[model samples]
Target: MDGFDETFDWVVVGSGAGSMTSALVMRQAGKSVLVLEKTGYVGGTTAKSGGVIWVPNNPLMRQAGEQDSTEAGIAYLEALAENLPGSTPEKRRAYVVESQKMIDFLLAQGIPLARGADFWPDYYDEVPGGCKTSRTVTARYFNKAELGPEWAARLRPGFVSQPAMLSEGLKLAWVGRSWKIKLLLLRIGLRVIAGKLTGKQWVSAGAALQGRLLKAVLDAGADVRIDSPVRELVIADGRVAGVIAESGGERRRIGARLGVLINAGGFAQNQAMRDRFMPGTRAEWSNTPEGDTGDMHAEMERIGAALGQMDQMVGYQMTRMPGWEQAFVKPPAQSLTGKPGAILVDQSGQRYMNEGGSYELYCQTMFERNRTVPAIPSWAIFDARFAQSYPIAGVRMAKMHQVWKDSGYLKEADTIEGLAAQIGVPAEALQATIARWNGFVDAGHDADFGRGARAYDQWLGDPFLKPNPALARIDQAPFYAVDVVPGDVSTYGGAVTDARARVLRPDGSVIDGLYACGVSSASVMGGVYVGAGASIGPSLAFGYVAARHAAGLDNSL
Candidate 1:
């Protein structure tokens, strides 16, 4: 062991959005900070996510003339989170009161934001307090070159870049739509190609926001060390004073006189943890990297730090390539662009939820149903027309014939009974399920599970179709069945803390010099995600709050 003393005003563990946000806030306050990242690169799961920040009643919404009030937002979240046992009135109120301030703070830092995507709907639009107006906001496009060579190398590669450029946007849209979306997509394509030819790398949305924040942190002269996992938190006099970090095959203590913040993400990659905490899950993660091992959770628990929302996690049950654990599943859009082609079913051949529901709802439903039945390997059965029209997991079904066959993911047959036989289901049961589904499509109604039922569920459907794109009848021939396993973006449970972002002891007293944010702490949303970007939004907000508080600034915007 080598002995080295490197001191900073604040020491932050993890380089994810939350940790970086806190570090940047402190740096802006003219405080010297040291950030320790466990992975080889910066940007935790956030880099790989859809980076829209879902803050209701933000400045962008106001500018767009979308009527939103803090009270309404609060009410809506309260209603949505009411189902979860961990949700508390205090957390919900805190989220609403501080959300606008967090948005304003980011905007002040030269981060531009666009209006919430109007096309995307809130998860529960039918519920009261839901707003049709866009509240999600993202940064203006950023160029990777702006970060300089050294910083760019530290960022994770192969992550989604921004600006919704032509190439990527078109490909994403093509996942579930027909050629009718071509013109809207072609315009984006032209801009992307033009930017590339002109030596400009325009990034937008999550990528842009993350890039800007990273650049700002680096610009403020904060030192970031990659591949340095914090092994332990040194507590003295009931306060976190510093950390013992393992990096470069050596261990050393880095002390922070002011405070130590833990933002080291959730335990998505820890298969054992997932199996224990989140039962029946396949533990397939499409996260940024594989280094997130819940080191913070273990280290904090060892010191008697209280844990919150331990049973909940952000579930993303997508289809994946067999044996290739990291790939996410895409929706079924092949033959059903203009007609219904496939249906999602549990082992009992019964519909459980709308197939078009966001990954959160899908995973929740899977887990909920798995409690009583075998939902580990659900099936998405479709027809040959769907195979021809839309792509599965981003590849045209025809193109992936070899891969699917080799991987045992593709099950095909000329008749429904044959397909059921291959899928190990009762032939009569599956046929009956399909027959009932066809009736619902023909009558333009979904009585039984309400497929294409709600406005929210139909938001992502193909606009070219007369009825709901997500509600096509699966009556066509050459039936197909692809398996969907339980997956996730990250775990949601972790160390317990308050609105001020100070970590609390199990007895409810604040750990004076310790702060925690991101998935390293229980979510303020109380385990019910409202929309896209909810995970990282609170992560960044609380990080700012924690840093400001640690720097002795009043948490007043």
Candidate 2:
């Protein structure tokens, strides 16, 4: 590293939502900001996401005549942070309260945000103070022409990246909604034609979210160095004053006048960290970017930055095809498990949970099951009929039997017993689990687990199908089985911070000139997934706070 006297008012590590948003805010405040990214491009997991930011009571919701009160949102937050040691009322209140103001600042910088959906329910709609809508916000489809091809090509894709509206993509993904899908496709076609005529491509979801942040940073003249990673934070006079960054295998010392904000994401890619902090996680099943090694967490911890929430992660049981690496290759685990005709079972071939639960519950259950039994990598067993209705890992495009067999990811047999033997589970037990599931399907109720009892689960499945679309029989021949692992959306555990986004020590002392956000910091929800966009939304809010505080500006906004 060479410390050739490069300095800035603020230095931020990582190029994810938290880091980028913080940089944008500081730059907009007329402060020189330097963004250091480990990867060759910008945007981390935020790019490969739905980009929904949960703003409890933004103006967009009010304009639509549906505004959730701060009191209600705070009530929800209080319930969420109940048992969480690191989740404080101050942090939760800070997020839900300043959400609108932080959004206003970003919107002024041309963030292109809008209310995510009129009905994108909180993941925990059943939780107290939770609302069906008026809490989620995201970047609407934005023209990539603003970034041009250079930066545009660097934008990563996750889930849906075609720049269509989030609502439209949700409709298209719902295979059962044929008419709605057609309408959305027609609208998309028109947009594509219009984009072609105007010489532009579009990005949406996570890509758009991070893209907008990056654009704001660039437009405000902030310096962002790609392929440069901060290996260590520089402490000067008991304060974080600079960072040692690596660029092209050479080290450079960049000084920060204000502080060092670490938004480098979590340790989802770090197996040793996973084994140490999050034993329930597996490196292969992670959905975060490969660059997310959680190295910064340990680095900060060595400097006395207290770590908490090490036991929390957000994930869904997911499938991996022959070439697919991350579990996010298909519809999320909730969609797969909640749908009818599939039963998730442990090594003993016994059903473990209500298949119609949310993704967060899936991770929590997998962790609990692994405690008593070897259930980290479970199996999803179904029949040919299920394949006809829904395809696992997009198997419909290829020959399901041949491709899955060749890949060794899918086991198929003419009978349940044979399938069980192929997968190496108890034959009788497998057969019994399926039989019980079928009985529940026929009875039009999940007698044992109540799979389709929740409105959320039912909404994910085909509403018009039979008694309960999430309950179906697996009696058809050519039954299939695939391994489903506890794949995380991201690790939600790490260095602890306060509502002002200031890092804390074990002795309850603030680490001056140091801050953290995103999964790099312990979540405000205390590792709980309250709804879609929970992580991204709070990341931006606190990152914004970290920037304002570092810049000596009023954080009350």
Best by lDDT: 2
Candidate 1 C-alpha lDDT tens digits along 1-557: 12336778899998877777787788888999999988877777776565667777877778777888998888889878853322467766776767678788878877666654665667666667776545676666678688888777777643455346222452455544556456656666777788788776666645666677788888889988988888889877667888888899999888897899999888777778777777655445435358767878888888888888877777765665555553432232222221246677788776676666556777788878878877767888888777776666556777678788777778889998899888888888898988988888788877876767656666656556676666677767888888776566778888888878788887888888888888899888876878767888788878888888889886553
* Weakest 10 consecutive residues of candidate 1 by summed lDDT: 329-338
- Where is model 1 more than 4 Å wrong at Cα? 1-4, 82-86, 161-184, 201-205, 285-288, 326-340, 555-557
lDDT of 2 by residue, 1-557 (tens): 13436888899898888788788878777899999888876899888878888887787787789957888888887776654545888778888987777888888777778888787666666778878654788888876678877887776665664759786776675545578678778889888888888887787888888888887788889888888978888888888889989999999888998898999998888899989977757877778887899889989998999998887887767776666663454334566666778889988889988876668778788779888987867888878888777757544624656776887877889998898898788999988888888788888888887777666666666666767757778899888888777777788887888888899998879999999998898888876787778888888888889998888787563
The residue-level lDDT of candidate 2 at 481 comes to 81
Per-model TM-score versus the true fold: 0.91, 0.92
TM-score of 2: 0.92
Which segments of model 2 are wrong by more than 4 Å? 1-4, 157-159, 174-177, 326-332, 442-444, 466-469, 555-557
What lDDT does each candidate get? 0.73, 0.80
